[model samples]
Target: MLAESRFVDLLAQVLPPLEFKLYHLKTHLKKCRKLVFTSKSDKSVDAYATHFFVLSLDGIDLLGLEVYIYESREYTTMFVSKADTTGHYPSDKPPTQMGKVVQQLLRGLIRYYLPLDKPVRVCLFAKAERQYLFLGSAKNPLKHVLSDAQLVKWWASCLDGLKSEFSSIKKCALQIPGASEAAVKSYLPSNPQLPWTVGDIFWEGAPDDPTIAVKRIPRFPDDPKLRFLEFLVAEKRVKKVSRAQFWIELQSRQEFRLGTTVGIFGLEGTVDKHESLEGNHSITQKEARLLREVTLEGDYSTKSSAEYSSNEFASRVPSYAEIDVKGTLTTPVVKRTVETPQVNVLSAGLVRKKQKTQR
Candidate 1:
């Protein structure tokens, strides 16, 4: 049994360890340019593996690999591998220093892997927002990078470098709005070929899908106005509406207006009294009072009075003492009195006594 195991030992000596095999693979990857990896399920390849692969190829010191296997809600097991703490940073350097170093490494990987001939799209998963931002040649790449302060400056610098490198490549799409027809035509291919516009050149789609529409703005010398192309390159159904039509539709929609009584949808002339559709009368008097209070006393009093009035006013029915019609407050009603008539009883009694005496 010992003699038989000796052959197995010899075979082990001939073969390299898994880590060493991976390291050798990394070397081969460096020699080859432009390697693209897609996930089995059409999602982006595991970011951890992609990072590790890039780091290894760049000849970064990788100490150990830690694999974590987790079970999802569907009872499916998924595994992820990360660089062990010992391998990720120098022993003497503090953990805080790792951030800059890691960022530099990522930048280096981007520079190395960025496609020279074609525009590259990158999907960045923002852990803070719990959202994925798709970045590419068509969209404003800098906007997404500037989203977080911690990474903004770093990404901006990286993007600057990328822009400089990509500047030499003439095949890129132009993002400037007022590009001439000749310039646009020269940069783009014929209609038979897939239409390539300045917008299409830079547009980066979501991670799962890498397709974008070629956006063209027709600019004729006779008609210097910019006209947007009506259709998407990928989806045939989505069409752009004319600006006039869009404005018309927008104005027609009540919800788009500021308010029923305030924008284009509002009453044309000055209104004497306005009643809400819900059968509730407008609280113009209260509003005017609050406004007056705010203007005279400032915010502190306004807030306190508002709170007090709100609490007090809710339970109380409105009185005719102050009535607001078309922003004017009517004067309070005045009380009036009526008098009763009186007669002289003494004169009447004398007349009756004289008549009795004569009788």
Candidate 2:
């Protein structure tokens, strides 16, 4: 665990400045020529033409899953050691373990983003041959689910085959574009056997909490920098925003189109007290997408008050305005905890006791 944490810390160091822009790429069609080719082999499968289809009951637009990729050169690297207690590095040893864990988890993430009906192209610029090879085993099982014995044998075969493969491999040439050398090294396994898990990269004692160890990669004197490389790799350029940076960007480019009305067809907020009122307050992005006109309902706070003040306090409503989504709201609004709101709500007796103390 210590080693794993350290690896993640090092990874935090090497990734370049990453940023993502929402491109409605799906709406923009590309023009391409159709071609026919003859093959002699019995299994002459056209890999490019081969596609799989995935069906989902949920009305999620698969087109929205598409992301725009851009090449960037600005990046820096650092090492995070477990020995540094005050630092963000994991509290473990042989930090390479953390990389294995992260790679394992990333496999699932890649699988998630992949179109179920199509083979997704992963353009991995191998920065470290050994590291990429070690991580490559992780991709096999993801490509095809196999028995435990087969997995073990498959891993063993890679080791046996390494000598022949590495004969032509040059360490110097094994470079990943736009990432730091140290970052590439951090992905390697400590031993020949690569052990990985989806959950292993999470920081000990702070599972689910985003902050673990974050080392700022210093910029070069001449480079024109944009977003950090690590942020781009993690797909968090928008979601895992630092509070400080959000405020800075919020000051600029502030206009947002509502895309739909607050409550016409599908726009409605769930009333906290009354089902009817609660329904009025809750609206979904999907709902907003369907709206031709957007009318600002009353302030969420005022609605919150009005809903609770009404006799139908038994039902709790969720407000769309209170929701946090990337590229939607200018300022973040904290909603009532999704976990039972009653946990935070004070009882009349406790409220009186607090009031008495204040008096």
Q: Model 1: residues >4 Å from true position, as ranges?
A: 1-92, 95-99, 106-116, 119-154, 161-359
lDDT of each candidate versus the true structure = 0.22, 0.19
Model 2, 1-359: lDDT tens digits are 22112112322332222211111101111111111111224232221110111100111100011111111121001101000000111112111122222232223223222223222222111111111101122222111222222322222222222222111211111111222446433333334332222111212233334432221212111111112323433765643444334323422321111221000000001111111112222233233222201111111122232233221211122222221112211233233222311111000000011111000
Model 2 vs truth, CA RMSD: 25.7
By TM-score, who's the top model here? 1
lDDT of 1 by residue, 233-330 (tens): 24352244433333234333332233211110000011122112222122332342332222123111222332343233322323321111111112
Runs with alpha carbons beyond 4 Å of true place in candidate 2: 1-87, 90-96, 126-359
Looking at model 2, residue 189 earns an lDDT score of 37
* Consecutive 10-residue window with the lowest summed lDDT within model 2: 78-87
